[model samples]
Target: MPRHNSTEKRAARLVQEITGEPYTVCLNAVRARSLAPLAARGVPRNVLDEVEDELEDAYGLILDLPAGAAPGPVAFREPPVAGGRAVVRGEEP
Candidate 1:
């Protein structure tokens, strides 16, 4: 019999029983979860930078934009069309 049966061993055994996986596989999953956050730390900033560049190339004035944020407000309300007709540019209704 083993001299020590710690919490980690018990948790691994429980996970293996529930998932039908090997004890070593269940223990490795816990280790992987601990390192996930640091591995994906730069993901949010990278996505923001890409969106900022794309918006700047299109809309020039994104109103109420924060001091140092991407100009992501790319939509504006056009004047409502009369009789529910589509409004074409440079054409008088």
Candidate 2:
């Protein structure tokens, strides 16, 4: 029988089961490597640099709009006629 450390064997088995890939050499020898570049083309560099430039150039002002600011005159004008009768006049029920 081979003298295999139980911990090492368990670690290798776990990695294989989790990754669904068989462990070739040893448990401690396994290494985690980036698979994004292989799976998909690597992300483009300087992606945020372009956005940073635009953000630095952008500028705006914050205005303190007063409360109860009506766009036009706030008068109690009679409402227009509806259904051939003025609703404000109480002519139509």
Candidate 3:
């Protein structure tokens, strides 16, 4: 279950404001469990459906490929090593 706190409440409110969505609908969106929780949380039926559709679209991207596919290595360059110490390559203080 998702944790509830002042920060979450504030965030939900902000989402509502930016999306022009009702506060309760935004809360429902956040509490969604396979799209059913949104219904119980008082989200308008049409908006809940739209939210579910968007969520599914985004979730699909999170797992676009089937398992057992060899994923590419994470790309990162190693920082400079000087006498077993990491050199501070960033801007000077």
C-alpha lDDT of all candidate models, in order: 0.34, 0.29, 0.40
Error of 1 at 37 (Å): 15
| TM-score computed on alpha carbons, candidate 1 | 0.29
Better of 1 and 3 by TM-score: 3
Report the C-alpha displacement of residue 71, candidate 1, in angstroms.
35
Candidate 1 vs candidate 2: the TM-score winner is 1
Model 1 C-alpha lDDT per residue in residues 1-93, reported as the tens digit of each score: 653346445544443343334466545433332212211322123222332343334422111223443322223223334434212233223
Q: Per the 3 Å backbone cut-off, how many clashing residue pairs does candidate 3 have? A: 0
What's the true lDDT of residue 51 in model 1? 28
Clashing residue pairs found in predicted model 3 = none
Deviation from native of the Cα of residue 52 in model 3, angstroms: 13
lDDT string, candidate 2, 1-93, tens digits:
655555446544443332233354324322222222211221112211221232233311111112332222112224333323112222223
Q: How many residue pairs clash per model?
A: 0, 0, 0
